[model samples]
Target: MNKKKWMRKGIALALSAVITAGIAVPPATAEANTGRIIGAIIGGAAAADEMNKQIKYYNTTEEGRQALFQELQEKYGVYYRWDLNSQLDRIFTNLTAAIGSMDATVYDRPYNYFINQQEGFNAFCTLGHNMSVNVGLYSYLSNEDEIAVVLAHEMGHGQKDHPAKGMKRSLGPTILANATGTVLGAIAANIWNGQGLTKPMEWEADNLAFEYISRSPYNPGATAAVWQRVIDLSGNNSANAFDIMSGAADHPSNSSRRDNYAKKLTEMSGGKVTVDDGDVYVNKKRLLTPAPAGGMSSAERAYFVMGNLAAAYRNGHAASAAYADGRTVMLGAQPIISCTDGDTSAAEIAALLNQIK
Candidate 1:
C-alpha cells in the first residue's frame, strides 16, 4: 500500500481499538505542545483563543453539555432524551472504536454531540470536544461514509481548536444578545446578527475536514460531493449562505469546491482517480455516485428557502449559507441590490429579498 494509505489504516485501526475499549484520546497535551494548531482556519490566535474559551465553557462536563442541551431544546423545540440518546451512544460507540488505534492523545471524556431538529442543514463544533449536527443533515446523509464525512468535518473544527478561537472572537458578545433574546423575542435577531463568524474560519473548517478525511479510509473525495448533494437537496438557492444546513459552512461556493476537490483528488491519487459533478468517483475499479439527486422543484425550493430564511434570521449570515446566499445581504445572488431600468425602492428590494430568502 502507499505510505498515506498504510498510515491511515494504522491510525484507523488504533482509533477503532481505542473506541472498542471505550477509550478517548485527548488533544490537550498536543494543544500545549503545538500551542494551538490554529493556522489559516480562523483569522488569528486571538480569535482561536476566544472560540476555545466558548467551547471549554460549553463541553467540559456532562452538566455543561446538559445545560446547553436544555437551552437548545427550549430554543429549537428539540429534546435531548430517549432514542436520541440511544442513537448518540451508538454513534459514540462506533466512533470510539474507529479512533482508539491512532497514536494521539486520547481524552477520558468522549466528545459531546447533539442534533437540533432545525429544517436546514447546519452543524457546528465547539472547543472542549463539543459538536452538534442538525437533524436536517441526518435526513439526507443516508450512509455511514457520508455520515463519517460530516462528523469528521465537525470534528476537524474541534481538533483544530477552531471553535475555541471562534467563540472567543464572536460568540462572547452574542451570548449577551442571546440572553436579551431570551427575555424579548425580538432581541434574538439582533443578537444572532452581530455575532457572525469570519469567512476564513469557515475555510479552515473545510480544509481541516478534508485533511482529517484524507487520513481516513473513507474517501476524502466525497467531501465535496456530499456538499453538492446538500446543495442539490436544498435547491440551487444560496440564500442561507452561512447556515450550514446542507452543512457546507466554512467553505467556498459549492461549485467552486467541486472543482477544487477534483483537482486535489488528481494530485492525491497520482492522476488515477477522476471526479465528475463533484459527487462521483471515476476509477478503474468502478464508478460510484455518492447519492442520488432527488428532483428539485419549486416546492422544494420554497421549503429550503424558508429554511434558509429561518436560519439566516436565527444564526445570521454565517449560519444560513446552506439554504441561500447568506454571505450577500440580498437573498438570491450577488450585486445584492437589483435596480432595474424602471423599478425603484432599493431598500424595499433588500428587505423583501431577506423575507423571500
Candidate 2:
C-alpha cells in the first residue's frame, strides 16, 4: 500500500484498538486521537500534504472564501460589514499596501479584509489570508495609526505562514481522512484560539507588525498603547502576581507584550520612543496611556492562580503539584478574602511563591 493508504489503515486500526478495549471517547477526543495516530504513522510529508489540501480548500475561490468567513463569523457571533468602498475598507487597503511593501509575497496571494461588529478589541487573519477587524476594536482605539498596528499584526500572521503552519500542526495527516465539517470545526476553533498562534508566535507577529509599522507613516508606539489598553481592560497590572503569569497559554503577558513593542519602537526610532507604566511617550511627550486602577481581589487572584496551576498540569510540568498546593491555600482562604477587599498579604504571597518553588 501507498504511505497515504497505510496511514489511513493505521488510524483505523488505532480506533479499532480503542473500541476493543471498551474505551469510550468523545468526538473531540476521537478527532484528536485520529490526528495523533496519523502524525505518528505518516510524519512530516503527509502532514504538509494535508496542510496544502486545507490551504487550497480555503483559498480556491472568492465565493468559497467568503462562505468560509461567513461560517466563522456565525460560529463566533461576529457581524461583519461587506461594503467594499467603506472607510474600513479604505483603511484595510492602505494597511494591506503597507504589509505588501514589507513582504511582496502578500501581493501574490488573495487577501481579503473585513470589518466586524464584535465589541471586543481584537483582530485575526484566517488560513486563506483573509483578515477581520472588530468594530469594538475601532471604538477602543483612538486613530488610524492604532488601527494600522492591528492590521499589520494580522498581516504578519499571513506573512509568516502561521495559519498554514498551524493547520499542519493541528490537522496533521488526519485532514486526508476527516469529514469536511469536522475539519472546518477544528479550523474555526483554532482561529478562535489566537488564530492557532502559540505564545511565541504571537510575539513574533508583534515583532513583524512593528517591522512593517516602522516603514509606514504610523508610529510604532501605537503597538505598546494597544497592549497597555489590553492590560487595563483585562484588569491585569504589574502589581497582580497571578496576572503576571496569565498569558502563558496562548500569548505573552500584557506587560511583556507592551515591553516588547516599546523596545522595538525604541530601536526603530533610534531611542525616540519612551515607555512607562503602560504609557508610550514620543519626543518627551505622552502619546498614549490608559487610566490607572486598583489591583484585583483575592478571589480573582485565587481563581487566576488555580487557572495557571491547571494549565501547568495540562502541559505536564513537574511543578504542577507544587502549584496545586498553592491553589489549595488560596481557595481555602477565599471566603475570608472574598468578603474583604480580596487583598492577599505579603507573607501569604511569599508563602504561595515558596510552595510553587
Which candidate ranks first by TM-score, i.e. highest? 2
Name the lDDT of candidate 1.
0.43
Each prediction's number of clashing residue pairs: 57, 1
Question: Which candidate number would show the highest lDDT if scored against the true structure?
Answer: 2
lDDT of 2 at 15: 31
Worst 10 residues of 2 by lDDT: 331-340
What is the lDDT, from 0 to 100, of the residue 95 in candidate 1?
Answer: 46
Q: Model 2 compared with the native: what TM-score?
A: 0.56
Residue 357, candidate 1: alpha-carbon lDDT = 34
Per-residue lDDT tens digits for candidate 2, residues 1-357, read: 997777656644543232221111236666565556655675555544544553555655565456566655554454545542265666667766777775787777657766655565566676567666656665555456656777777778778877666655554455545433244334444554443457677777888877777666554555665555556556545333222112225556676876676665455444543445533344455433322323332222222232222223223442322212322332222211111223344345435433432
Off by over 4 Å in 1: 1-56, 59-66, 73-109, 171-196, 215-217, 235-238, 245-251, 277-357
Query: Model 2: runs farther than 4 Å from truth?
Result: 1-52, 60-67, 70-85, 172-185, 237-250, 278-357
